[model samples]
Target: MLAVIRYSVPESQSQDFIKQAHVILDTLAGEPGFQRGRLARSVDEPNLWALVSEWEGAGFYRRALSAARMAMYPLMILMVNEPSAFEDVYVSGQEE
Candidate 1:
């Protein structure tokens, strides 16, 4: 499973955004079934950012996100209103 949260942040608050993103990722990392996470800024759009995390399954993703929602309520509000969870049906590196 994957959780991809996107944000539209002012460039003036870039540093602050990164710091907050780290806190979010760190918290998610401690949860069971967490695989990896990354914070990325769009090359085409300077104010666009994404917080991507991989999990073992949808259940894991939901639990971790719920935990994050409770713990980081302030930062969680910054996530753009959109669907964030996705099932990983395919991965390029894996053999068919």
Candidate 2:
């Protein structure tokens, strides 16, 4: 499962947001079933950021979200849109 969270941060707060995002990623890394995660920023629109995470399954992702430590991050309040989750269907050059 994949989780994609998009954010629109003001220029003044971009640095602070990045710092907090790293903290969230670090926290998730210690959780069970967390495959990997990364943070990306749009080249065309610097204030636009995305937090992408891959989990072993939907249940693992849900557990991570419900973790008590996750509740402390202010990043959730700054999201520009609702976070999205997707199940992988296919990958190019990969066999089933």
Candidate 3:
């Protein structure tokens, strides 16, 4: 599995950004290699968000996302984590 993490400050035109973001997410969701995506925001830091996407190991998420959202994406830090262990929502767990 691969997880892509994007960090960005909220734009002055947030609604417009969000609208454009949905388009990208929707397109990716329908792609054959996409597994799932989770959009998370920090309660204490309103301007921060993490878009975590899981993809098939064979897919290149960066290229696909860049192609789909070049116009909509503002300058931001993007990190891709592959060959790293990630949480599986379907797994049974024992907590600390």
Top-lDDT candidate index: 1
Candidate 1 error regions (>4 Å) = none
**Pairs that collide, model 2:** none
Estimate, for each residue in 1-79, the C-alpha lDDT of model 1 and write its tens digit: 8888898888888898898888889999999999999999999998889999999998998888888875557666567
- Assess every candidate by TM-score: 0.90, 0.88, 0.59
Which 10-residue window of candidate 3 scores lowest in summed lDDT?
A: 76-85
Task: Rank the models by TM-score, top first.
Answer: 1, 2, 3
Q: Which tens-of-lDDT digit does each residue in 59-84 have in candidate 3? A: 45655565666543553333233342
Instruction: List per-prediction Cα lDDT, in the order shown.
Output: 0.86, 0.83, 0.58
Clashes in each model (backbone N, CA, C under 3 Å)?
Answer: 0, 0, 0
Off by over 4 Å in 2: 68-72
lDDT score, candidate 3, position 33: 71
- Tens digits of lDDT, candidate 2, 1-96: 898888888999999988988888887777899999999999999989998889999998888877825542587677876747899998689888
Ranking by lDDT: 1, 2, 3
Please say which candidate is ahead in lDDT: 1 or 3: 1
What is the lDDT for 96 in model 3?
31
lDDT of 3: 0.58
Clashing residue pairs for model 3: none
